[model samples]
Structure formats: C-alpha cells, structure tokens
Target: MTMPIILPRQEAPVAAIATPVGVGALAVLRISGEGVFDIAQKVFRKKNNPNFRFTASKGFRAHFGTVHDSEGLIDEVVALVFRSPNSFTMEDMVEFTCHGGPVVVQHILKVLLDEGCRLAEPGEFTRRAFLNGRIDLLQAEAIGEMIHARTESAFRTAVTQMQGTLSLRLDAMRELLLRSCALLELELDFSEEDVEFQSRTQLQEELAGLQEELHRLVDSYQHGRLLKEGVATVIAGLPNAGKSTLLNVLLGEERSIVSHMPGTTRDYIEECFLYEKTMFRLTDTAGLREGGEEVEHEGIRRSFKKISEADLLVYLLDISLESYLDEVPLIRDLLERNSNARMIVAANKIDLATGSEERLQKLRAATGCEVCALSAAKGEGLEALKRLMSTMVEGLDKLHEASVLVTSLRHYEALRNASDALANAQELITRQAETELIAFELRSALDYVGEITGKVVSEEIVNLIFEQFCIGK
Candidate 1:
C-alpha cells in the first residue's frame, strides 16, 4: 500500500459531540490531538482524587469529575482517556460523557472550546483515523455506509466491507499486478542482453487469469447495486385496474388514493417494501392509456420511463372483464421494449370476477412469465404475490455469503477500468508486444486498483468522498 495522504488541516486540538445531536439520557463529546490530555486537565476536577491529573492518567481509564470553566461547573461527567496510538484517531483522545441535553451539551462544548479545542469538521475524526493508519479509505467509506444503511441487507454488506473483506481481496490483486510489472520492467532494462526473467507465454497466462478475475468483480456490480439500493419495481396497468389498491396492500399503508374513475391518478407514487431480506422500491405509476389531456400525456410519458428502468414490472389486469384479456398485446410490447427487465402478470379483482381461475390460467399461458391471481381490494392472495416477488430475485442471498462484493459505484467504475486495461495487456501479450508496452499497461492497472483503496488517489477525490458524511463522524 502507498503512504497515507497528507492533507492540510488546522493544528489545533479538535472536539465534537460523538453521539447524535439531541436530548437523550447521555451524550459523548470527543477531542483528539497533541496536548489533548493537557486541555482536558484544565477544565476537569476529579471527584474524590483531588490530585488526579489527565496527563498522569492511564489510557482507557475513566475518571468521575465535574467540568468547570471560568463560568463555573457545567455538568458532572465521566472522562474516558485513550492515549496516543490506541484511540480511533490513533492520537491522545478524551471522551466526556455527560447528561444529554441541548443546553447541557452546548455548555460543555463551549467550555472545551474556551480551553483551546477547535470544533471537528464533518468526518474529520474518521479522516484522521485514515491519515493516522487506523483504517483504509474503503473502510472509511464503509463506515459511512453503515451509518446510513436503510435495510438489513445493506447494513450487513457495509459491515462486511468495514471489516476488511473487500480490501484484502483488492490488496492481493495489487500484489500480483505489481509483481508482473516488476518482471516486465526488468526485462525492458536488459534488452541488449536478450535476458528473460519469465517467458512471454507464462506472462500471458497470468494476465489472462487477472483479466478473468477482474471481469467477475465488474459483473458483480449489478447484484451489489441491488443490495446497496433496493430493486426498482414499477406497478403498471390500465386505469381502474386496482393498481393503487395493490400498491397500498404491498406497503401495508394507504399511501395512494384509490379511485373508480379512469385517469384519477395522473402522477406516480413510490414507497419501499421489504420481503425477507430483499428490499423493493415500489412505484405506482400513472395508468397507461390512449392520449388525453396534456398533463395526462406527460404522466404517461413518465410511466413508460419508469417501466423502461424497472428491475421488476408488475402488470395488473382486471380479470373481471373479458376486455382485460385483450391487453395482452400491450404487455407483449412492454416486454419487447424492456427485454432486460423481469416481469410478472398480476390478475386483479378475483373476488368479484367470474371464471377467475380460468382467466388466470389463460393469462399464465399467454404471458410466459410468473402470473398470480389476487383481489387487491379484499387483500387476498398477498402471500403468493410476496413469495413470487422474493423468488424473482432468488440468488442475491448467495451473494451475501460471498467473500467480497462491490457495492460502491466508485469501486465498480474503477474495477471496470482496471479490467479493461488488463484486457488490453492480454491482447498485447498474445501478439508478443514490447516489454515496455506491457509494463505500462500493468502499471496502469495497478494504479486503478490502488485508487479504489486510496493507495493512489488525489486530495480532491478524497475530499469529495468524505464530504458526504455528516458532522461528528
């Protein structure tokens, strides 16, 4: 790995609330830097030990004390000490645990500031951890992901990444690429001697192997995206087909307005639904029909846009009417246009429809996809629909068990670029290209992989990544 980034920051000791900013039973304020213990000693007085001093305190030791300043005592607190090279930032740090209240916390913070502690910036503490060699860049990003995770799957994936599962794999890849580049460079330096450190055919085999592995990592991005962000599932059909009702049933809330009049829902509504471990971003789109008002036309345009981008399309049909069967051709058109998207046919209003089973059979035979019969209004057949939805994305659970998965778009793009460079190197090897040419390609690939783990990254890119975090992280 390359050396840690050296970004310019203020030299003063930094302090910020370690917990969420709200009234709670307790709150923690952390400060870290050189002379941090000295600063803590200025405002803290040990409860029983009158001679207790932070500078003389051992690491990981906690002292019951009252934090007082020029104005007097702010609050009674527990001061936990972490000596240099042991804390989160790998610096001398102290965390003050006090009663959680806006006013109380603010008073303590003001006292710390008055005693010479600068407020911490957004993500500054984690950035210090990275600069001080406590965690890598990927792990830093994973920490942010863990904080903002919305689903259980997302949380688990983030936790795995933060624990170094993905970093270890990328580091191994870097070693292999670096080894090949060194060999190729040595060959270039001794061109006149006609010396070969390794045979060209053997080098080609190594490059081909790396290329295959890179391809696997690049291809896994799609599955990783589904884990990081929920699947985009769109609900679509003609007006008055109980689309709104189905959306409400799936969400277990009356989120959309149900109506009998066609074109009542001229816009789209979206919500999240979690089945098993998978999350679905369910969107109830405006009904598709022939042209109507200008506003309706725009809504239809947007509905098609959503359908085109969906991972799962639920085409609802009112099986009560024989005319519903006539909509098959439209379904075929949608499938044709979006052949990449998985589809399911939902025959609705079975409670009031005659010969519903026969209609469902016909629909099943016609659509060539998963078909389910349900009465959205009465909330029947919901279990089957949910089970089918879960089965639609069946293999994601296996991905969770894999050693490493790429869930960040930045990582995905970098992997793709690195894989493409390796591909080029492979072709050059097959044709017995110059050693310098191969070495250059190998070096490029190495750098790209390093960028993902912050081994060879720019300060601007680093700032952009850490800026996404909230303050006190």
Candidate 2:
C-alpha cells in the first residue's frame, strides 16, 4: 500500500497572473488560499453596490466589481469566487478578470500583493492541484505538454494523457501487481505448510499478462517521445549540395541562406515544419568536405554531432557532381555510428542532372538505403520527400488513438524499471526461488509503478517535475 502524500501547510494566499502577460481584451489574475475572499474584499467592490460583501459570495459565483487602491479606482473588473475544497487548488480562490493592459494588470496584482497575497511561484497553482489530490503527476505533466504542443498530433496526445488514459492503464497494472504481491506474501507466511496461495502455473500466466502490458507501455515510449518532441532530422551532404535549399523548400520560405558558393553554410540552421500532422525539426547542417576554413571545420564538427543525434538523416547528394559516389563512405560511416537513425539518400539538383533515375539507383545500391530524386531549388519531388518522411513516422498517427501511451521520459524510465523487476519475479517463480525473494522483486515492481502515478514519490521528484511548468500554470 502507498502512503498518502503529506503536503506542507500553506500559511499565506498565493496570487499570480494566470493569463499570458501583455495587452489583450482581458487578463485573468488568480489568487488561492484560505481567507482569499477577505483579501479580495479589501480591493474589490461590486459596481453600484458599495456594501456588497465578497465573503458572502457563493463558490463559482462571478460578481461585476471595480478594484481600487488608496488613490482611486484602478480597473473595472469581474471577480470570480471559488470556495475551498472545490477550487482548482482546493482552497478559497478568487480570479479577477480585468482589461489586459500591462499597467492595469500590474496595478491589480500590486493591490493583491499589498493586501497580503504572495506572488505565486512557477507552476504553483498546478502544484497545489496535484498536492491537493486534484490530479496525478502524469496528468500534471500532460498539462505541460498540452501547453507546449506545437502540432495537432501533439495536442491530441497530450489531451488524451490529461484525460486519464495513461493513468487508468497504469492503475490497472498496479492493481494486478499488487494482487500478485499479496499472494506471494501469503505464500511466504504459510511456507511451513508447504501450501501455495498462487500456483506456479497461475503465477506464470498472471506474470505473462502483466509483462505484456508493461512491454506495450514501454514500446510506446519511442513513438510517444516523438510526438512530445518533434523528430530531429538532419539535412547533410557535400558543400553546395542544396541542403539549405531543401530546408527552404520544405519550410515553404527562405529560412536559410542559400548560395551557389561552396561552404556558404558554416553552421547548422534548424526549423520546424508539420508534415502529415507530425512535426519534423529539419536542420540544415554544414556541408561535409575536406580542409576548409577553421569555421567550416567547426561547422563540419557540429554536422557530425547532429547526424549522430538525428532520428532521421537526409543525406543529400548533388547529382550534377561527378564525385557523388565519393560520399558513399561518409554515409556508411554515419550509418555505422548512428545505427538507430533512419537514412534517406536524396539525389538533389535533379533538374540539372543527366539520367537522374540512374543516379538515384546507383546511390541506393551504394548506400543500401532508400534514395529519391529531387531538385530543391525548383521544388521538384519535394512532395515525395515529404511523403517518405511522413511514412517514417507513420505509426504515430495511430498513437493518438491509443487509450494510453507513455510520453514522459520519467514515466518511461519508471515503467522500464518496473518491467525489469517483473521479469525478475517471473524468473524467480519459474525457478521456485524463496518466497521472500519473489516478494522482494514484486515489491520493487510495485514501487516503480507507484512512482508513475505519484503514489510513492519523493518531494524532490515532485518538485523537479513541477519546476518545468511556467509560473501561474
């Protein structure tokens, strides 16, 4: 059984500008804690009702009011009240929706702070919600993902996670593991009787099911990570091989400086584009060549680094150049170094090449990789290139439809550890190891799964997770 999270008492009310800072039609400032209504009463007065008492206002009620300071009225606003135990932070909460002028919002915040509300720390609101049992760690992280989502697919994935899809799956896995652990412990207690609470065959069957579920979640981390962080794609090749042009064409704008001169691009230029609902971070790396200026060499160094880190490498080859095949060795070395990175040989400058198809075949035969012909300058065969890239990330579209996908590195690591522990337990059961040994492995697996749902986590881990969130989230 997991111990309940014990949160430290909050002695003061916390307030922050919940909305993005800047001038807009309206800006929302949030305040939450005990006696929040009293703090609001000091600054807010309902319009046309000077004697209106904020403390008497019901939860979820909104009142048209004007905020004032010692000098005069600061801003005519609408104040929303959310009483304790039902609010986002499960505390007495007040939200002032005021005109979104930098001066107006700041003045309102100044008055609240003067009235004894402390400025909220980064992610403090969300942190409170988690500590108050409103949401789990996985859901909290999903909220962050939703906020930073750059693509429709990413948004959908985060939304699904926030809706408790992943939580439900994990909870089910935990319950199964807990039952198995209880049975194993019972066997340990009754060891002198030589009785098995759970038969070996039954335990094996249960473990097989648990392992399958764990493996499914573990397998999802790769695709889920891709959805969370866009695919890192490196566009690399010889100098003036149209790597920058391809980037510009892919982005549908002149994002990179494209010149006919060799070694024009000294460093990598990165940009993101949505291809088939998936985000691809395309990086135009410095052309790889022997002996250039010092800066070019540094750029070449960075290119190799990017290639090694890339999820996909677009190895562009200038078909117009006679030494196109000379890059075969470089491509092979890159492939050997980054065995996981998918490679695509792009025969660029096809418009200026003779027998482009023959060259494409030769490049494919030489590299043993998929090759395509394209003219980045004229935007020829760009669709085919995009289609191929999309195909590489094709399965991610189905991930959005999944009931659960482990998207966080932390959750992935926890699930991996739990899976390993369960594997150990399964082996122990097979070998008829001591009941205490089997129970130890089972307990280890349970603790790992508990970490995912924030049931058995340290304060340090919780703080680190919430620290990534923006203030007032």
lDDT of 2 by residue, 369-446 (tens): 988889998889999999998886565445434456778899999999999999999898889788899899989999
**CA displacement after TM-score superposition, residue 379 of candidate 1 (Å):** 2.4
Per-prediction TM-score: 0.90, 0.90
TM-score of 2: 0.90
Q: Per-residue lDDT tens digits of candidate 1, residues 1-473?
A: 89985533324699998899889999999998878898999999999888988888899999998999887888999999998777888888999999999889998899888889899899988888887768899999999999988888789889999999889989999999998889878888899998889788888888778888787788777777788778889999998999999999999999999989888777889898888878999999989999789999998999999999888899998989879779999999999878868888998989989978788888888878789989999999999998988888775445434556788999999999998888888888888788888888889999999999999999998898889988778
Q: List runs of model 1 lying over 4 Å from the truth.
A: 1-11, 192-194, 264-268, 293-295, 395-401
Q: Compare the candidates by lDDT and give the number of the best one.
A: 2
Itemize residue pairs with steric clashes in candidate 2: none
Give stretches of model 2 more than 4 Å off: 1-11, 189-195, 252-269, 289-302, 354-357, 364-368, 378-380, 395-401
